[model samples]
Target: MSDSTQLARQVVQALLDAGVREAVLAPGSRNAPLSFALLAADRAGALRLHTRIDERSAGFLALGLARTSGRPVAVSCTSGTAVANLAPAALEAHHEHLPWIAVTADRPLRLRGTSANQTTEQVGLLPRAEVLDLAAGDEVDVPVGALLAARGPVHLNVQFDEPLTPVDDWVPRPTTARPPAPASTPEPKVLARGPRTVVVAGDGAGPAARLLAEQAGWPLLAEPSSGARAGSHAVPAYRVLLGTELAAEVERVVVAGHPTLSRPVARLLGREDVEVVDLAPDDRWQPRPFPVVDSAPVWRVGDGAPDLEWLDRWREAGRSLAARVRALLRAEGDVTPHEVAGVVAGAVGARDLLFVGPSNPVRDLDLMMTPPPVDRSARVVANRGLAGIDGVVSSAIGAALAHGAEGRTIALMGDVTFLHDQGGLVLGPHEPRPNLTLVVVNDDGGSIFSLLEQGGADHAHAFERLFGTPHGVDLAALCAATRTPHWRVESVAELEHALSQPAGGIEVVEVRVRRDNRREIDERVRNLRP
Candidate 1:
């Protein structure tokens, strides 16, 4: 048996020992040993292996799989540019603090400067990742404890010698997962309850954010994907309310997780008069970006009574605008993006998974959806780490597959985002497909830019060509290419009816909307204040 085969098997065993039950593989030459080993593990029921032709998609698939399963997942690709393709996903994982493992096949040390094919210093490919560079013939003494303990990205670059494939037949080994090392959690601090405060729950902010707000009688400004959004304190149209007069009365903010959705929230946080108290624990990277006056591992309400009127005023103001928002939404009868987001978001049931994309879709979702029922679970997640519209389709699929069988998944993404990784729908007939309903808000172009400053009259002339970049592709035909089911709806009634149908497998619900008048609608929404 070649040493390369032995090393690959050891690496596979290490992954299994580390409790990595899912892996994505992009076929390549040098990584053949790893691929065969992964396949063997899959056959042995040690792990589930997913294969993708595109390394980029494979990385995100692993990312979403790990995210939902709450366990480390690995994506292996060949060396050189193939390794580079996983960089974007790695960067996203680093920022999001997800443990994404990248196993890249590399050429041995002897081929470093010898013009070897597909060999270009794979060690430093993922800058933010903790790299374990393994050469051609090395012993299997890896720091499994530290690797498992790392809550961020990890890169494992393996160098294979002349024998890329296994010379001997490999049998998968069943391994038991090591018990995790225990770590101490900080005692939650107490926040004095005098000042009027609101909890700002951003992406990945857990249920603690909601419990704190509910107990203290404070409004919760939770982003759509924030796990805390299900509680009674959550304010749905928070971005709109952020512009109201009541928002100016905020004396303090108890922020958790990372908030990057609206300019109004950013401006509110920037206010020097308002005290910012962050309860967010240190992530894999830097701490909260705002100028926080107080920081804690977690926080509980102090003895003094909270300002009840402050929260009531905010809720009243938010409720007052709902009628106006509905009026405006009804004024222009055609299916609007907000309506699309609302319909899709409202359709989610208890324990259902909702995965949104970056840009307007999530923002629209934020505006139109209300909080989930307090007792039920409706898990919402996004790639809010970098918030780029990359590989979202694949991520949603990965998430759906990992989601429990009790509930289904509904994914909301824009046309551009849906198109970005639409190839995710190209699954083999034998692949284990999940029951996921993917809804695409088809505004035809980058409608998000129109709501930004670049949409002003001064830049109107260049906006369509530069920012919009409209693509006239036939989406139904595109879905047809993969033999996936698709539905295109142009009205609210049509959308409701389409959503009412039972979703069995991976399907696309393309809600057609217009890009024009987006700025006008958004301005009206922002103007809806108490």
Candidate 2:
């Protein structure tokens, strides 16, 4: 038996033993041993395997799987550029503190710096991850230990020699029970309750944020992906309300997770006047960008309850703002991005899984969706760590597949984001398909920029060329190529109907809207006050 084959088999088994339930592979010559081993494991029902042609998409795909399943997912790809393509996902995982194992196959050590093909410093490709560079003779046990201790992303760059294929039919041994990933001990901190405060919950803030708000009787300004966005304390259209007079009265702000969605939230955090108490702590490389008056890894509500009048003010403001925004949207008299987001949000149930892309879609969701009174079981996810439009579709698909067979999965992304990872739709016939409904807001261009400073009247000329890049791609034809079901809706009625009857397997509903009025609508929405 070849050492390459033996190494690959042991690594695969070790990965399984280390709690990797899902594995993503981007095919290449150097990784043939790992691929063969993985395929054999899949055949024997040892773990689920996903295959992607694009290394970038494969990386994000593993990201979704790891996040939704709450399990460490392994993404393996060939040497050099293929390994580098995973940087975006790896960086995101690092910041988000997700357990992602990147198993990169590299050329043998003898090929280093000798003008070898596809061998450009694979060891340090992902600096954010805990990396272990291993050769053919290296022990797999130490690397497996790193995988077990991985709090965030981990990299295993293994070098394999020629004869990458297995010589014998490798039958898998019964794998041991996988251990649970260790949870961080909650750093206890008691926050004094007299000050007028609001709990700001960002992406992955979890239920602690909501519990604190409810217990302390404070308003919850939670972004959609925060998981704490529900409950009675949640304020609808909170971002818009942040500019109101009520927001100015905020004496203190209790923060959790990484809040990066809106400028208003950033402004609130950036305020040197407002004492920002953090619960997320400095988990990643960079500390919190804003001033942290107090820091804790996790928290609970302190001794006394806050004033009810403060909470009531936020509640009334939220209701008023939501009403005003709803009226304004109705007055638009045309199908808009916010309306589409609202329609999609309304379709969410307790058993549903929602994956939102960065940019406009996430913002639209924040503005339009009303949080439920109680915490619904619906899970919302986004790649907000770096907040870039890379591999969103592939990540959503990966999330949906790993989310199990119990509930429907819905993904909201803009046309450009959809185009960014369109290769994710190119699934092979033998690949496992997830029941996913992808809703694309086709504005023909990047509408999110239109709402930014770049869309100002003075910058109109350069905007279209750079920021407002309109791509007139026929999405229906694109969907046709993958044999995926597609629907194009232009009206709220049409959108509601389309969302109701999602084409079961893998489908897309493209809602067409115009970006010319984007800035206008945003300005009007901002002007709204409680």
For each candidate in turn, the TM-score is: 0.97, 0.97
The CA lDDT at 151 in model 1 is: 81
Per-residue alpha-carbon lDDT of candidate 2 for residues 301-333, written as tens digits (9 for 90 to 100): 767646889899898889899999989998988
Q: Which ranges in model 2 have alpha carbons more than 4 Å from their true place?
A: 138-142, 180-187, 375-377
Question: Per-residue lDDT for 282-341 in model 1, tens only?
Answer: 654255566889888778888867677888887777767766787799899887999888
For candidate 2, list the clashing residue pairs, or say none. none
Give the C-alpha miss distance for residue 373 in model 1, angstroms.
2.1
| Candidate 1 Cα lDDT to native | 0.86
lDDT per prediction?
A: 0.86, 0.88
